[model samples]
Target: MRKIKKICFYVLLGVIGIPSYAQDYSISLLPFSTDNYDEFSPAYYRGDIVFCSNQKSTIFIDYTDEKENLPPLNMYRVEEVERNVWGKAELFSKQFKSNANEGPATFNSTGSEIYFTRNNNNKKKIGNFIDKNNRLGIYYSKFNRRSNEWSEPTPFKYNNPAYNFAHPSLSEDENYLYFVSDMEGGYGGTDLYVCKLENGNWGAPQNLGPNINTTGNEYFPFIHSTGRLYFSSDEHGSIGRLDIFYSEKVNVEWHKPIHMDAPINSRYNDFGLIIDAFKKSGMFCSDRQRTSDDIYAFTPLYPMFENSQRQEENDYCYVLYEDGAENPDPSLFEYEWTFGDGNKARGLEVEHCFNGPGDYTLELNVIDKLTGEVSYTQAIYPLKIEDIAQVYINAPDTVEVGQEVVFDGRKTNITDFDIYRYYWDFGDGRKTRGIEATHFYTIRGNYIVQLGVVSREDKEGNSEKRGVYKNIVVVGSLKERGRRTSD
Candidate 1:
């Protein structure tokens, strides 16, 4: 790590050249994936996952829908065998069965309660939905500890046979409920809506505004513990078909939605994303590999960051106030800073900027206006300038044609990172590896220099490589001097 002066109050995190926030995601289709079956909408529950799938159930033989000759979507539970591994998936419950379709779901923090999607006419005993459901509806159910089964499902008070209202997601505190609906007065196909749990019942629904809804469609709402909302939309845009997007509500308004990057998204329909509170790993639904949607587990190579400000590049600047000198007579002699790099300043306190990494003998002389130049030097300090702890390369940002520029990594400072080798890419079809290398440009132009630092593997056989870059400008002659880079 690069150490900042106590005055500056800046600390360098143990990262390479990367300062901007990003997540490198790796994904894998779960072992439960089947070619003929469809599975999606994974929800964390009871230290495991409950998802909607149309796969045949082992407990209920011949569970296929007789009308469609295909299995209808049903809730299934999968237990995690270990990290990033899951065992077989089975029917979520026998008591929570419905005659119509059952889709996306969300569970309370304790996993004892659930709010899920089902056909509004699931019972089909009332109103105009006697034979078929006019649209979807949200229902709540709880685990019955006495019978060791799920209790009877209760319809949401706002459930109307006129429009669709499904994909329920609950807030961490269960104080707010987010869901999708096309009930009317919406932007387009489907819009996200939320209701506050005032007293003991849910309040009126509030639209998420035009920023979240579009003329297209948005569904699969998942409210993370951080209050950021994740959902799928096609009107906003698409990488494949329906892509996943997330937005954070500031104050009362929601920020513009941000599209997720691929493998989380793909050239196929991707939606129903559920990630952990740490944002390190999670599972999502995508149809990139097969014709049917399948749940895939994803993990990030590095931790994700939010609300992180951009880091300023260090310029190797420092101030020398006391040169570790004994008390000297201020009336007799004044302090003069003689930096061995051909720079000199006279003061008790002065600032200096080093060009690059090297060893320099810093001299402190005492002189007075009343007296002539002091014959004796007050302090002789050995100042060795080293680069900040990174895959640091010491090179001039500007050079001349045919000028031998020294590329040095000897001063690369990193205590925890055990570097095995240093690799260089001059961006001119040339590459080399060492602590130091010398190169020259044939023609005057701009070239990007890359320094690759490789680390030794750990006991787990895991290693990483970090590359840092520098922009070098080459000039034809000395008369056309290049601009000096920041010190």
Candidate 2:
């Protein structure tokens, strides 16, 4: 028998500052998630998702006793309806479906292998009635590419016939497996454990230690690609029954977990977090609505720079340029456009472009279509406009060869830029850098004069360069040109 070890976990209730790279995520409940029954524990398998739900199952008869209305949890797969939205749900594996519970599964990198939690179906009868042996345990299955089906589940090595072991999450490399178990040698009602896969065999399960496991249950251990572990714990300070928390691995050890906070978490059971590869967006399960647990997708609200920060190189603001010809469209109701630069317009549709790139307050004063009351709403809109250096040459197009032609580069205009260097290439093996230059063409012919300007503003090498070329016809002296024309 394993020795039971108990350790105390001190919960920290204060909120910590979020990291700069961390995102302010917005949550939206998936459309397919129902209101009555429970649907939770979403895991990504390739592009689709596999989750646990207690929805109506044809194979299993609803168990009515202490638990009513809620059916046995089973694994179901939902395809993408359009982008993040999902389609109808269906049984993930027909062969693995049983009268017992099945749920909370994960797939290996290639998605060729899967591990799931299900109640032990093999039971013993005590009397005239049958014992279903409802203890949950992890199960394994393999996919056959040719047949397009999943193999019958086989009990995992760590699964026990008595104690419960469920909620399996795999590392990206599939070298370490994390799960929730209530077996002996845990700190609380349930604790998280990890087992290493060595030489094609899983080693002995090791407890995640006191930093993560607590006197209360810790469920749904998901290891992100960044080695950060996410789980739900009733032991830590939570807004409600259970809240999602994540801890990063430092110095080869797990640190104290931190609560995910509001929006992602709420005053209800929120758990089962699954992040994408980049860790920018993903989905999770929450019962914050007071209904059953439903799945929600989250994405970060990025700064104004959707692509690059260089203002002039990118389009900072889009000019809607609407005349409000279409009325009562609802979308155009209370139409007003206030370009942050103090320029305002009123109509069903209007357009405004920022004068230059800088921080501005774009206020939209919309009048109530029916009430005629005005409300000004403003948001911080950062605009950047590229100030391009331009060179305009003002010189005579035709000049006598012996005449002194003055080339001026002072006409170059660089908005919000200081011209540091001006270059002139006379196309006559002569080049000079200055605002103005005098050149005498001794030979009569068509000469292409080029002007190049360079402007530098800061030490960071934020510079702009622009060039212009002009064709000049330098005729010979009047008498020499007349002699050539008469011949």
Candidate 3:
């Protein structure tokens, strides 16, 4: 049983591609000063990066000793000054705090609501009472653009008490919240959970399931504006420490996650990912730098798949019929037949047929010995001939006065009858010729429209004739006094 499971696992890896397990993505590390203890958890907000760092100097001791126990991490922002280069880092509002370990921040699409992880001595005491191992929990704050400051941070409260939650990401619409938790009932050490926001409150948290979370920790999930998810995982195979990976939602379900390759991942730990929706560039945290962990900038190159190919060809043949009977002979009165398959036949009407059922772009290249260059090309869908007398008239059977109506006389089983001509009697003194004829009623009355067709034969032995009749009614115009009375 174990061997069979192992075989299935390997087959899955093969289908997704083995190189993805160890591929390294290209990245540029953020320049670091020697003063910082660590720098990580870079999140995107309005074309800038909001991250955490411990760049304390002798003159600036930011955190208290109790806060230092966890880590002296403070949130910072780096704006893009040029194409690839980032401007110098600056501290966010004091409401974010320079005194505790504050990091891993995400902003709503409008950059108004901020969610970040902050561990204070007071929160640590509560965490310790709940679980001696609980290190930190995520917090939320809102930025007031008018005041240019953030509101006081508040601990995010979820239903789950046994789990340690951090690294919160709000969906683009702020309707869903995704976070990482080292909670029980998970497939691995830590897993990603998403909770829907209902009536402005966070609802139940759902595990991202085995497709994303594994026996190892999965953290730092950043959902791009396009709905693709990026996170770090050690459970799935990685090049080194927890490497950054991405998964895209193709439809309702999430597709298999892909690893960002070599240069983006190394023997050192890498996490925290962010990307701008419009610019297509973003930043992540990596310990690949020489001494301490630092944030890096990267642009993702999406792969493309090949498209399926198709080919089609068409062929046509013809047969001639006269008096509802097959006829043979080429030299007769002038006749032209079009197969509706880009092929034509000339003589006194030849029965031209298509190779198959499809839209055939055809042209009737007719050469009148008298009126040269008489050509007619039309697009047609030639249905299979089922019976001989299946004639259809396209016009309505009833119409009002002054309305022009058309009558179409069509035959099914008689193939070689193309050289035939149509005769239409509008029953109102109007007569016309051709397969289709149009006429307008001059007076109000019920009239029986008639269409007659005669097929030309080569030897003039006999002629096949078919006709159909339909009734139409035309209404007279009302007088002005009667129209007003009706209204």
Q: How many residue pairs clash per model?
A: 2, 2, 10
Best candidate per lDDT, number?
1
Q: Candidate 2 versus the native: TM-score?
A: 0.57
> lDDT tens digits, residues 200-250, model 3?
788888999888988777878988766678898765777665678987553
TM-score of each: 0.63, 0.57, 0.54
Instruction: Pick the winner on lDDT between candidates 1 and 3.
Output: 1
Report the alpha-carbon TM-score of model 1 versus the true structure. Answer: 0.63
Error of 1 at 5 (Å): 61
Q: How close is candidate 3 to the true structure, as a TM-score?
A: 0.54
Candidate 2 lDDT, 130-160, residue by residue in tens: 1224566798999999999888778989787
Check candidate 3 and list the clashing pairs: 23-261, 23-262, 24-261, 24-262, 25-261, 25-262, 25-264, 335-347, 349-419, 351-416
lDDT for residue 363 in candidate 2, whole number 0-100 = 48
Model 2, position 456, has a per-residue lDDT of 63
Global lDDT scores for all candidate models: 0.73, 0.70, 0.61
